[model samples]
Target: MNLAVIPARGGSKRIPGKNIREFAGKPLIAYSIEVAMRSGLFEKVIVSTDSQNIADVALQYGADVPFIRPVELADDYTGTRPVTNHAIEYCRQHFFEPQLCCCIYATAPFLQVDSLLEGYQELHRQQDKAFAFSVTSYAFPIQRSLRKINNGVEPVFPDNIAKRSQDLEETYHDAGQFYWGRSNDYLSSKKIFSDHSIPVVLPRHLVQDIDTEEDWLRAELMYQAYMRDHN
Candidate 1:
């Protein structure tokens, strides 16, 4: 069975109470929870959070908070891999071992049900040896990326010094929206990317990370526009 895990901690330095903060009249995490549930790909949606308020809100929005996240995992320095590992082990101890796992973020409020399910279906259809993640085309050509010199001059990668944006190759970036992978693969690599990692393309507008107040406002606006267009 596939299990969806949403990892949210109590200590958020960028935006306090970000997980439980209201968005579109509901807590932000609710968006991810609802999308995962509506997708119908996963048999269960579990939220691992250190905050009681976050756990409560997740439960109210159709997510199961089976256990409170450990204090060590809640620290700011803790990387997602360990937190995911902890949650997976926790589930295994209580329930059956999950075959597949989708790590959904509480910050990605605009994750589409169709896109999510498609990502899962794509993973299975390709029978990919690695993981799958949702990503969007980069706004700019990464090949044209420039770095600032000590003298405040822009240094180009090719050193051609004059390259047109259109001439550069297009590349995609991880949208940080969500990722799906086999439980065994994740346990082995401790990462979502592998030789066969599948990048499911999504529109850039649909990908938003709410790490700050301004980001939250932008997400709200984008979400409203998205709703209107769909309607």
Candidate 2:
């Protein structure tokens, strides 16, 4: 069995009610729900949320809200690990334990059904590995990243400043869109990235971590571009 869990809490300090907020016509959570449902990959698609509104919306979009997330796990300090684990364990106790579990964000509007299916395909191709995730090449080298200081800002990795970007080894960052892992690894390891993990590189233009208003705008633009080209 395969299960996709979307953890959405009611509280949102960064952007209030972010989970249920409208994005490109539908609620933000709708995107992940829609993609997961349409992917035809998962045996079960569930949303673990603390908000009744979110649960209703998720169900309307064809996701199962089996149970409301605990208030303790719905707080701002609650990391994704616990929420994901809780959902996985919940399903394990009720239904058959899933072979693979996907953790998708409620607010990730850029997560397309095609890319999600591609991720599942990659995961199947490398089933020997513990996990697989969607990622994108870093826009800038981490070595060239900056840090704030009392006097002035300084390079985080000063040694790489002299080297050309092309010469530097490429490094990838989690696109924050989604993660797919074996159920046992997810429950036992407590970490998403595993020794047997592989990164599925997505185009930079298609990747956006929407944390703020600016990020939301940029994602909308990029998604529009994607539609124009693909359609």
Candidate 3:
């Protein structure tokens, strides 16, 4: 079976009720659930959350809340791996052994069905690879990044300051949308950012991280613009 585990803890400090907050007309998590269902890729789409409210919202949107995440895995410091591993183990105990598992983020409002499909397909094709996840190219070359020091700014890489942007290697970052992994890879707690994984690149316009109020506003604007262009 293929399983989708969406880890949405209730304690969002940066933005209260962030996982369930409204975004572009529905709860933030609804987007992730809807897209996963629409993709028709999973035998089960489950939301592993500590909030009863979150569980209700997830079930309302057609995702199963078979179990509430444990307190230890629901804290701010808990990483995605352990939460996912726990979910996988739970499924195993219940006789729903997932062959492939995908960890879809609740805040990923920009996630698309095609991107998820691509990651799924890529992971299946690369047997040697342990995982596949979404990524997007950095808007600007990171080699020329700056940092504030006292009253002045300084180049992070002084040696790359003189080099043209075109001469620098292009870089990509985790889109924080979804991750596809073999059940064994996840159960083993393998790292996602290693050479063992593949990346499903997404367009920069279709990616945004919503961590703060400003980020939320920017994401809304971006989502509006994307919808207009796509529709």
Taken over the whole model, the C-alpha lDDT of each candidate is 0.84, 0.85, 0.94
TM-score of each: 0.93, 0.92, 0.98
How many angstroms is residue 185 displaced in model 3 relative to the true structure, after the best TM-score fit?
Answer: 0.6
**All-Cα superposition RMSD per candidate:** 1.6, 1.7, 0.9
Best by lDDT: 3
Model number with the top TM-score: 3
Question: The CA-based lDDT of model 1 is what?
Answer: 0.84
Candidate 3: residue 170 Cα off by (Å): 0.2
Instruction: Report, for all candidates in order, the number of backbone clashes.
Output: 0, 0, 0
Count steric clashes of candidate 2. 0
Model 3 per-residue lDDT tens digits across residues 99-204: 9999999999999999999999998789899999999999999999999999999999999988999999999999999999999999885789999899999999
lDDT digits (tens) for residues 1-231 of candidate 1 = 988999989788889888888898888888899999998887789999999988889989989999999888888799877777777787788887988888989888889988888888888888855678988888977766788889775756775446787777778878888888888877785456656688889999999878888988999999999989989
Cα error of candidate 2 at position 80, Å: 1.5
Can you write out model 2's per-residue Cα lDDT over 40-59, one digit (the tens) per residue?
Answer: 98889989999998899989
